[model samples]
Target: MSGLLHPFIQLGYGLEFKCEALIACALAQASTHRKQFSRALDTETFDEIRAGDLDGGNGLSLLDIMELMRIDPITDKITYDDDPYTEENRALSQTLAIKYAKLWSVGNSESSVREKSIEVMSVIALVYGSLTRPGYRPVLEFGVMHNLTSSYFLPILLDALPLHKKVRLLHAYAFTFIYIFATKGCPPLHIPPELTLADTHRAESAESSSSGNPWMEVIDKAIANNDMHVAKVVRALWRLSLLTAFPTQPNASKGYELPPYINCLYLARITVDSINMSTRRDSVTDKLQLTAQDGRRNWAHGMVAYDEFWAKYGQAL
Candidate 1:
């Protein structure tokens, strides 16, 4: 992983490296990347990577690799979704975990910021490249899960993106990777309750009934606990995934403003200068309730912005 990202980072695709690598890896597979990688990880071969068919190549999910290495157990609480991870791939995952762990540490460290950042991107490439094979893991790991987008990693990533004109491309590319990984991959072929940004709107729904707007609360207790099966998650993901590569900003003049979040869904993963708005303190429970008189407000419209965004960019990559 130390030198894996070197090719992409040098090409100024740091932020976009994962996306680019995802495409490259997918093309290498069967001319498609993991159905666009969860639209998760795509690789050198397609038939060998799908679940339940480990015949042609090595079939190891990231969890299997990590469990084989005995790493990330504390931070990543996940189960083996496939067959028992045998001793065959044990050595491979261990070697990967070593490089994976190094990248994780360097990514968070403040020392040698620039070099460390390059190494981080390289590791992403290296790891993803490795997974392009049959025996490799298929999704992001504990430190790499896109769902952690809302957590401390965002700030760390923000810090890594130096505020320099010459290096702005790095920020963009880095963000591109962050955007998809966060929104798309939760668990392999599954979107956990937390991964769906739609639920973030739902989390704030109950509170919207009162004076406080739906956008006020970012993560609602209810939404976090809400669980849907993989089938529904996959369908929603497909509709949303194929609709747009990048998430869009709202046209609304005002709405509740939750804690600030970076929008790297579209913007070529260039800069944090995308857009930051102060949403008005209002919410509509449904499309019909978009603008009610006294207490007919709803948060469905809050969710509409995203739905419409995918529709708007429906034909894009």
Candidate 2:
């Protein structure tokens, strides 16, 4: 097999350089400036480049073309999502990935941040579709599934706005694709369990009955895992915690204090999207044991606040 494969690999590479020279010559005419190669290429017909479906084009092997485009699997940082590299298209997967990682780290302001993140994600989706070969349809489909499902959290998670506003944004994004996926019999897709944020109030329910700090314990475990999504969720919760019953400075006034359990549910629902069925069962058991003395009224009020907040900010996004 190696004997046959060695010759095939050599032949494939020969085809690639032959394609590259032709592309370089064709695109060179589009620009007098040699430095404009990437920009000029970016504007060219990319369909055949993407699908390797062109007739009598360059006869370049898909892997060879991708290699010349700097998508060589062994040496290049960017992995192939698709096939042939064309004279008209330039690779931007690595560029966009670097940009996203930076934005995610610095954190954006509420309204502007959401818009920017969506734009970035759109670029990512397009590039993924355009650069891969037709044979990679499943891999591409899986990527789309993962991205769209995971993206459900952005509007809610990043919005510095109130709970209701976030939920409305979430619902809008969710409603766009939720029905289609649900009809296929998928549960409203859950974020990876490690990625979902637990509200401090929810975290505290068991501990409030015991003598310990339930929410803090949860944080400790989350930290030990060192998960980025979990950490981001924790940051959002900390900001929300100021509004909840969690302990803070004594000087903190009304709006900054803890709200109700209902509010926790509303926020959690928005921020995390799909509820874990098991967690819901635990919630029911906890709710059953509650008395008028057990803080349900406060929880109820929080839900109201969430509703009111959502009403005001829902359309902002």
Candidate 3:
């Protein structure tokens, strides 16, 4: 649950490949994360709250929960320091994250587990792909992007765990997602209708050939690029695109609707476009020159100012 999800991701790969060594490494990594997270996980304080919350049946979906948090006065109270590792900042943020995250329930049944996992995957994609400042060039925020990439492993990890462990893992994952979102200043989400409708529009067009599929170009660039993050994000979004295609109906019983903005294929295209804008091919080597600093420089970090984000675009809205 810590280390920006690297430990869990490693464990996912280990399980997928049936490799003992990688699993061992993941366990070792988990042992080194901040003690506060471990303590929070061990505490039973939320058990009663969770039970009472679940008694009313299904709670709000992750997307709805995020919206509540976004507008809540508490969101304004979450402040970040230049050094994110400051103990005071982390303590305050994690406390709030757990408080709000408990609002969502990971059900005990197998079908519930599967449904909850998909719900999470969709919401994270919405956050990662849609939370951009209008009129400015798209910049995938560094921290928020991890929530999407880390989610790619949820299905893999959940499949191997027992029902109880699966529920616990989802809780931890939710906590992490909320904490990161708060730290990123709870940026306002805006789903561009054009981006979400890209797939539908393409299918109806005359030029709907294999060569015309935008994903083909996105994939080519992703594979050609040397950055591992680009490849991971592309693969994750592609997997999500496939998963989202068939589940057209919102789960009324579970109280979750597939938000209109979640078109994973187009989200993948947006990510690739953003990366292309931030990088240039070296003339001599004919390869992209992407450095850690270059990646950080082009992305928005910390809180997003509401006034600035809406300054130029508010009139149309």
Candidate 4:
């Protein structure tokens, strides 16, 4: 959660929603109170265990890892305290969040500077502007942090959240957490649900209305342009994003069910495999991996803001 938020803040989009992610991380970290994860997971033992788990080369059971790491598990329901929005705080749909983000990444007051900057700037402004007004954080749709902080422990509630919110959570997990865990190596923050397309399709379809697969759209565009390199990146992003949204069970191929956190190494194994495929995959991924890892700590540092910019503007390149 902090990983995703602090980066956006440094990127000059200090919207409250991004702040919410950090706050959520702190609150959840402190939820146990007896032994704060903030203090415990920092020790060398935990880091060694994290690395050792990867070296073992086996199934990464999040439940077993959580027991070892002593990270509290969320197994219930939780929501934001404030619903003072213009409308409601009903989990900002992922589609809506992306849509709003896309909308924000555009012209503002009719006299903005630079052409390309407008798109990204508009998104920052939309979220930031909506946030300054007191009752719009929930309306704008950036619950990646909320879910990260809360959802890991309470995956049962994933369906309750709006489609956009679910998408935001998946985006954060794959783009931020999983990426960091795989390359830079870090403790797994939260475990995404290990459900499958079959596991979640019914509910997600009902909630999202199947507005044509977003992943397919990306793939289609790449094929149309004859850009295999772009296709590789897009495919990697799609794989991670999809995992966040509909993670397969531990033995998904063999058939299993899980809503548990696994080993960081095992998680990383799956994630890196997901991201680094296709002949076109190459060193360009280093930059993306760095962004995911660095964006967490470092405050006004560790920034990784250009993913959306690149994804949206891939055609220009």
Better of 3 and 4 by lDDT: 3
Q: Model 1, 245-283: lDDT tens per residue?
A: 234422112331211221112111110111112223444
Runs with alpha carbons beyond 4 Å of true place in candidate 2:
1-100, 103-108, 131-141, 160-317
| Candidate 1 vs 2: which has more lDDT | 2
- Candidate 1's displacement at residue 33, Å, is 36
Q: Rank the candidates by lDDT, best first.
A: 3, 2, 4, 1
Residue 24 displacement in candidate 4 (angstroms): 27
Among these predicted structures, which one has the highest lDDT? 3
Write candidate 4's Cα lDDT for 1-317 as tens digits. Answer: 34333332222211323555664555554453443123213345333323322243223222232233222221011112222111121122221222222111111211211221211212222221121122211111123222222222222222334644433332232222222211111122222233111222221232565465443444555454332323433332333333333333222212212232222222222222222212233486543231222111111111112233223322221
Q: CA lDDT of 193 in candidate 3?
A: 77
Instruction: Give the total clashing residue pairs for model 2.
Output: 16
Better of 2 and 3 by TM-score: 3
Query: What's the CA RMSD of model 4 in angstroms?
Result: 22.2
Candidate 4 ranges beyond 4 A from true positions: 3-37, 48-80, 83-317
What are the root-mean-square deviations of the candidates from the true structure over C-alphas? 21.4, 23.7, 5.9, 22.2
Best by TM-score: 3
Query: Cα deviation of 97 in candidate 4 (Å)?
Result: 26
User: Candidate 2, residue 19: CA error in Å?
Assistant: 56
Residue 9 in model 4: shift from native, Å? 13
